[model samples]
Target: MNGRITVRIMTVVILYHPTMLLNLSSRHIPCPAKTIFGRRGPLVIEIGHGNGSFLRHLAIRHPDWNLLGAESSLGSVSRTFRRLKHAGTTNVRLYHGSGLFILRNVVPVNSVHRVYINFPDPWPKKRHQDRRLLQSSFFKLAAGRLAPSGSIWLTTDHAEYFDFSVANGKAAPHFSVDTTADPPAAARKTKYARRWIDEGKIIYHARFCKESEPAHPIKPTITTQPGTMHHAILQGTIPDVDAFEKQVHAFDSGHVILLDAARPLGDDRLILFVRVDEPELTQELLVEVRPHEQGVFVGVMPFARPLSTPGTRAAIRITSRWLEGCGLRLQQQSF
Candidate 1:
């Protein structure tokens, strides 16, 4: 993979049309955005809708069923979005993140009618198996969220990965597996599935149906703030922040990384975007430490809604202490 080529392509797509990408964090609350095309119907999720080619046809074929694509790659998301928009389809929307993120946080539990995973990257290397998307944890999570009648459809060209997935699916406590020699014809219509078919490669397709919802489903709760603020206030003349350097702080619960720091000229506000990685949560948040009517306030920026958690509050405390090191007087604190 050429990094330069990818960067160039991503820059072009994002520069041309930025709004094509949808915000997964805000779209779905207790339920997904229902009423697509003025009709409420079953929801079909396609994870890693690579080029959006199959998605184009899938949406066209099932106008009534809402199609939600969860993809991580900005390039793929943008490309598929353009394709869907060109086709003028209204039943499809995309979530710009991992499949698990949307499933666990956004999509309503027991609401997904079907899920399609077509040609996922088979991280064939043994050392990279930890990164594979198909795992017991994912299966359990999927099972808890899927309807009683809901099913998962998976197709991959890698035989080893195919067998591995099937083994896990069969062992899932909440699912019943049905192996298919060939995936759905709609899947084969995609460029990926077609190329494999042209090469006479054997593609494995399997459907896993939910036996029953998990009796004790692990539905993690995200503690939300009233409006979108996670900060503390202080009063002092801000000292000069010498330099913006990479800094990492580790703790038992999780770790925080001060990735980069920035500030605008003639403005007393200092913006720092840091990555907070916790047990099951990962977020990159912009923290603002600047002058307030009282003195200096430190808080998560409202630009993006980051899940406020123990780690984030810890981040505020850590940032304040770091600021004290850089010359700040504490008047009051609220975290």
Candidate 2:
């Protein structure tokens, strides 16, 4: 086998960022979500960037705006990082954290000018409906973090997910959702989107903008017990180490655990992933672990409901104790 030919073949599918005589280091740091880039340039955030093709295209096409991408999958993250590095593009930042986590913590409230959720996994099972990212709670959170005139651009091939997204967006108290069958003329098209269109899947697009607040305040909260500290760590938020260890102890000895310590491209933020055997349970328990020094940081664990509940309080106590024992501080946030 000719290795050179094989490498060339692989390169065809992988797109790289173009090299410019700009400061690449400065563009690589992960700043707080509210932090603006490029002085007067509009800030754009893309969630679930697959191979970074679309993002790369957008970055090249719109040189004035700063582009930020959040991709949770490690494979995708590696691919994206390589694409950006090879292309020598310095105007984009990549995060290995979840889109929601980035929006909540890294992004400052009312700082984002545009948001994109493209080709996200469509949790098809009825029982797994809550896993969909376009749910009511997500909409509310996005609305809160979005700038007044900022807009959310969503595209999906799954008809059900698309319709569900529209419904959730419309029902959202703050957003006015608008749907389109075609991509906006100026929007960059992704390979996935183009493929879906060619395969006769009617692509669904929606633009959600916050028009006003709800008549009644919507307090969105995610509740999980203390023993689930690892969940948050994987989501790229700081985690309570003591509680995390206790949660780990609760697991069966035979269970598999995986942890990846990663630094986002262009930022000081460190992303730590604690993976477990049970996918569903793992996702539910995710907490954000942020490191202050090299190894120390605070963990914020959100409750599915208010922590005031007796059961919830008990779980938090046990988890807090475990985290303290492990040398990590813990904080509980209702929202």
Candidate 3:
């Protein structure tokens, strides 16, 4: 451990690049495999699928499988869609967000057949290594989604990272490092794979099998209650909306920071964009405060289509409490 460089995780997990999402990418997946594929099928997930050639091949090669690619860059998602569309591949679907988000919130437990993390961002610097996806924490989270027979296929051209992944995968109790080899034929054709190989760089490949289900997997219930959405109003005076600058409110489930607000002239609703960070998930969505007959209504914006979870309901409460703190009289409220 003397020469081993320490990798520190970056706290700010930015989900996506706004330019990359641009109406093309599907919204945050609340219900992972069910909503997109509509039926149960063999699920294959690829994280940070750059350029998507890796995903397109998997889709075309295996027509019976449901392929989901979670990429953070808009350009990556758009280009992948274009390529898959050109190939006329229908089983492939894309989501523009951190791979962690999809694995933690979207994909159902024990539903994935395999996970491909091919030539992921090395984040080579010691300080940025925490951002790399194959760490012990990530492996635990990813393992939670793998079926009894599922395995994680990881490949990288960075020698240090490859060693780190192997060591990290072993550190997690529920997984076993099954094998290591040169990049597989299917992955050897990737842009990075080829570039590194041509430069005489050695790629590290590992097949990590799930030995047992994680004892304490993150399984937060995602379903929203009856009063979670519409028709339920919070009866409170929403004091003047002037002091509504950026504010961070912490609740039991997680913390939500009101990023900013917008009032589309003449609209009945006041839109508040906020960042919600919970134990298993992180989402940036809108909480709308609309004028109600009794007082004012604060709820998750439907158009934004956020995951209706405990954290989101907590967001509704946070917004309501912020109003109460700002001198709003809360007689009765509905969650």
Q: TM-score of predicted model 2? A: 0.58
Of the candidates shown, which would achieve the greatest TM-score relative to the real structure? 1
What is candidate 1's lDDT per residue for 209-327, written digit by digit as tens? 99887877657445344454457777666666657777899856788888767676888888777778875467667788888888888988755446666678778877888888777
Ranking of models by TM-score: 1, 3, 2
TM-score list, all predictions: 0.84, 0.58, 0.77
The local distance difference test score of each candidate is 0.75, 0.57, 0.72
List, residue by residue over 1-335, the lDDT tens digit for candidate 3: 11111110011113233321222224343455655766567888888889999998998899888888988775677678777778987787777677777777667788889999999888999999888888988888877888897989998888888889999989988888965455568798888888988999877789988889887786634533333452235565444455446788787777988877666587767777777887646666667777877767777765433556667766777777776676766656655
Whole-model lDDT, model 2: 0.57
Q: Lowest summed lDDT over 10 consecutive residues: which window, candidate 2? A: 20-29
What lDDT score goes with residue 246 in model 2? 21
Clashing pairs in 1: 234-296
Task: Compute the lDDT of residue 215 as modeled in candidate 1.
Answer: 79
Which regions of candidate 2 deviate over 4 angstroms?
1-40, 185-189, 213-247, 250-335
Candidate 2 structure quality by residue, lDDT tens digits, 109-191 = 66678998888899999999998999988888778777777889987889999899899989887888777456654333676
Best by lDDT: 1
Residue pairs whose backbone atoms clash in candidate 3:
20-74, 32-106
RMSD of each: 4.1, 12.1, 8.0
Q: After superposition, how far is residue 295 of candidate 2 from its true place, in Å?
A: 18
For residue 12, model 3's alpha carbon misses the true position, in angstroms, by 21
